[model samples]
Target: MQNVFSEENIKIISQIDNWQKAVEIACQPLLEEKKITQKYVTNIIKSVKKYGPYMVLTDYFALMHAKPGEGVNQLAMSLLVVKEPIDLEGKKVKIFLILACPDSKSHIKTLKEVAGVLMDQCNFELILKGTKSQIIDLFQKKEMDGGKK
Candidate 1:
């Protein structure tokens, strides 16, 4: 789906180095799309950070096994888990594509229908045997394509 957050929000989220920042960045697009309110987004982020992926599983039945534990790893896992269909300002939001560190192939099967699923092994092998920048550049290109890539 097309990203709803403003470019400034996307930039702010992307520039930050922390997982919290990443979560904020991920949610910004949904907030702007009106698929979720700011309050809901904040709550989702907080819940995921504290309780893990279980936060959205009830709302999104497909996320039955999305619970991650604590800390940055959990936070990253939470972001990777919370995928739901949403309506943004009238448009129906379809997917939430996550790009992780390649080797962390924890939930590839769960995201079969969304879009790209980069397994850590596949990504790591490519980076070591091929070019690391290609993956990063792909993400950049996707972002530039407004999430359609």
Candidate 2:
């Protein structure tokens, strides 16, 4: 099986100009890997524009995703850690988690795994300041632990 949590899927950037740019940057890896089509990115942005920053799950994190089959090609997830926070309307978000799951079932597992990590303040801080390898390891560890602590 191809590794879902590879270094290529994680990015650490100094900053982003805007929330839309941040979403594009976060989904770039997945787009290049053909995990999702450009439409998926557009859909997420449009959804946010229409519904506001509902994806901003936490003060520092935003989980960007559209419904399944919008353009998802596979079950994949990517992360973008920005050194400086991007303003999503009024919310400040530095961590962008882009998800491209082909179906409902796969996203649940992915969401659970991500929630496990973010639920812990220590892990969340580590990811905010972590190297790409460190972030990859954190996700791998989460998956290995079956989304447990």
Candidate 3:
């Protein structure tokens, strides 16, 4: 199994003033890689504002994204975590997994791998405190382990 995460696709932000900025910051890696544009980030925030905090995956985690095919150049992702939680309306989020994809189907495998980690508290905690390389290594190790329990 191969890891989708790398040093270039991850960020650990110390703080953010708002959820909109958080989504923008989380998508920065994708932006830098030319995988997505600023418009994609704006659409994501717009969707969240219209729909509410339905994307918050867990207590402190969120999956930030918009519908594919908007400004996505390819399937790519980034991880963003903050030192403290920020308000997304009523919910608080400190971790973000932002994704941009070439098509609707391309990111399923990626989401599956991410969901595997999200299901394991131990793994998620490691992600919370881990450095960029440590975070990438965790995903690689999990992939090599075949996501074993």
lDDT of 1 at 2: 24
| lDDT values, one for every candidate | 0.34, 0.86, 0.84
Winner of 1 and 3 under lDDT: 3
Write candidate 3's Cα lDDT for 6-68 as tens digits: 887788878889988888888888899898988899889999989999989789899888988
Task: Tell me the lDDT of candidate 2.
Answer: 0.86
lDDT of 2 by residue, 1-149 (tens): 13457888889999879989988988999999898999999999998989998899888899889888879999888889999999997899999999888988877756776777888999999989989988888878877776677
Better of 2 and 3 by lDDT: 2
C-alpha lDDT (0 to 100) for residue 89 of candidate 2: 75
Estimate, for each residue in 38-134, the C-alpha lDDT of model 1 and write its tens digit. 4544554565556654423222121212223221122122122222344322322222232221234543533431234233345323322333245
TM-score, predicted candidate 3 vs. hidden true structure: 0.92
Clashing pairs in 3: none
Between candidates 1 and 2, which one is better according to lDDT? 2
What local lDDT does model 1 show for residue 45? Answer: 53
Could you estimate the TM-score for every candidate? Answer: 0.33, 0.93, 0.92
